[model samples]
Target chain A: MAVDEGLKIELGKQGVFVTTIEELYNWGRRSSIWPMQFGLACCAIEMIATTMARYDLARFGAEVFRPSPRQADLMIISGTVTKKMAPQVVRLYNQMAEPRYVIAMGACAISGGPFKQGYNVLKGIDRYIPVDVHIPGCPPRPEALLQAFMTLQKKIDGQPLTGPDRPRFLDAEAQGEFPVPVQGEHDLEPTSNPGVWTVPVVIR
Target chain B: MASSPYFSLAVLFVAALGFGLTPLGLAWLWGRVFSPAKPNAVKNAIYECGLESRGDAWMQFRSAYYLYAIIFLIFDVEAVFLLPFAVAFTGLGAAACVAMLVFVLMLIEGLAWAWAKGVLTWA
Candidate 1:
């Protein structure tokens, strides 16, 4: 059962903490989001800066950047997702443990940015894997990365632990593996994952 | 049994074990109930560095490398021990000197064995 905010505040005033299982679960999950340590391009420099002293991301409890996808809770796709690199990126995302989140940092990752017309660049990473937050900019400042991280934390906090609206990881029926795209004769075979992304219809 | 000297130690030991095991038990129970296992080929793969791992991790090495290992012990390990022994030589007792001598002799004997076996000869 959900506790009334007013009642919870009153309990806190009386030195007693009031919480539900969902709140406690979400709080713990959102607090310790360890991002995978791989970086794509120039935007990766900003990602590194976000974890460094001045913009210290540890304040949000996401400082630990795990080298292995197995230990990571978040994947910060910081930079351009070239067609050549896209397969490896999707594979890394697929290897990540359940309850993982992705932050498509910078315009390059969200869209191909300046390289949109280029033959090699992948339009966006979200075409293959789902993204939780998108931070726009050629290479967004450390502040932008920090903001995206907070947005992800908010998203995590609001997720229901049970019932129909619960997050994908909690749902046993949810798709387990995001298919790792392969390098075909021309471009990435299958283009995009049908499960996560659909062809954006053009207006006449 | 309550009045026995070891009774308190038993209680403390139980408490220490409970301290460690309680959280582990709770985590296992929580995982079973909330997070269902969703293992797949990609997620269960041995290598985590994105690239597909090729071939078996089990590979054979040459048995002749044992001679190099012995030689390394004689040269590298001997220098490490000898430096400390030399530095403290002035304050060492006759017994300590004898111990150092025995250690040096054992390393020399290994070198001698390797030399006699033609390990020092470059093919």
Candidate 2:
């Protein structure tokens, strides 16, 4: 009986600890999230800030900034997209493979912000390529960007890719102006479940 | 006139090792005690600064960056060769100076090739 017990323990040492599909998938997803560093203007600074000391984006498992678009799974549009830059932006969007997400990180990207009236600006980025989330603010605070990321997390968890709407963005026809009501701004104030969504905006 | 080289080298090596080790060791110990649990579906989702991760992160990259990296490598190699001359300048005199000049001329040729190929153009 003792010999059998010893054999069992030895077998345990060699056995694969994660045998289930859920566990394996979770492992792959949590590990290596490559982000493309495509900064066009001002909001790019805030994106850099997210990866810096106070924010430390590495903690969230997305600090790897891949210069190549093919390797990245997330693209943060951090500034204005001018007519000159539009074709380049569309080309970039096409280069990325399926199952990717775009974060429009400022009013400029969300709806061209103050530059909406300019003939050079593309208005909202959704006009060119789909936007998964529109983060408001002249430049949304880094914490707000973090909140946007969490909302993305929730969407990934709950939603299914049934058809066209499954992707994290609104359809071009459904696209709207800046500061589309999505959620509250990030607050350092003490709260029960700090990251929970308070206000909900439905974009049809 | 300079102090013994051996002592100075030893002190420099020890200080460099200490600087690299302390933070690495501290982070290791801290992780052992307080590592967060591995994330699941909910926790592992992509962050959007605080918004949802939308669309795709992948994009087309310009080919100019590769050309720039190649140029950087050429200059980097030139710098390596120049270092030896810098160290032995007083002893090597005019012959070494002329050789370095020749080497720099070769490097400039490579730059000219890149320019002719139009790799230097932003577009």
Candidate 3:
């Protein structure tokens, strides 16, 4: 009936196709991931450089960096997270539409790097948000970021589209929104945490 | 009614809504069901360059940019009106030609006025 079909018959091949929806879904998800363009410190510069022509992140289909969290699929925490800025970071993450990802792009974002001891610096962004990939470096080189993208793509390929254990965004009811941190006199604290400013509620 | 020609508009309107919402809804559904939800105090907080914001983010901005936009709008309107006239020039009469010339001259006069008033200058 068709040229390819005739060749297939001549080769003695059966054309029965077999695949689950999850595999297809995962394939699509792994291809195009839009990352949030916002960045914090020195690592942000490297992140921008990765998207430029030299490194060319567009080849991996992740070059489109969205300014708005609602449109972004990935959040590359590109710098140190401070106590005051922690709440803001979480807020941005929460604002992002589902099927989102997070990649800690540098030593500062991973564990505060050299600034870990600083009074204002957060020890690690993982303390605030769930990081999917951690790219370890003072400011991870563009090449390293490319490697991280490959790793993340591999992880995305393993995900299932539908099942008893589907993505949190698809579950809807199980979807958790991070609580906005309240700015305290000395430091920032989660409002949901016990006894932020006042005394803890005591039951006699 | 479905028989009406305006029915196409209704279909388009509904299709537009579906087009915009489907991708967003699908993405949200996928993320919520599959992605892990491990939010804490720090995770939920706002991000501001890894530091505590000292004051309110609101600040006064200069309104001088509006003058430039107004000037651009004037030229934009001129082009919009002139583009059709330019394409239809061979079919136009002398009266129409004179009318367009007068219209263009008025805009040039306005430009001259703006130049005289120093609106063209950045200072």
- Give the fraction of reference interface contacts each candidate recovers: 0.75, 0.00, 0.15
Query: For residues A14-120, what per-residue lDDT tens digits would candidate 1 score against the true structure?
Result: 99998888899899999999999999999999999999999999999999999999999999999999998998898898899889999999999998999999999
In the range B4-112, model 2's lDDT, one tens digit per residue, is 7688888899999999999899757744543322323322334422234677889788976987787996789878988887898888778778988888888888899
Docking class of 2: incorrect
Better of 1 and 2 by DockQ: 1
For each candidate in turn, the interface RMSD (Å) is: 0.8, 15.6, 6.2
Between prediction 1 and prediction 3, the one with superior lDDT is 1
Give model 3's docking category.
incorrect
Question: Candidate 1 lDDT, tens digit per residue, B8-93?
Answer: 99999999999999999998998898887888998888888888899888989899898889999999999999999999999999
CA deviation > 4 Å runs, candidate 2: A1-27, A161-204, B1-123
- Best model number under TM-score: 1
Clash numbers, per candidate: 0, 29, 25
| CAPRI rating of model 1 | medium
**lDDT agreement of model 3 with the native:** 0.79
Candidate 2 local lDDT, residue B92: 79
- Score candidate 2 by DockQ: 0.02
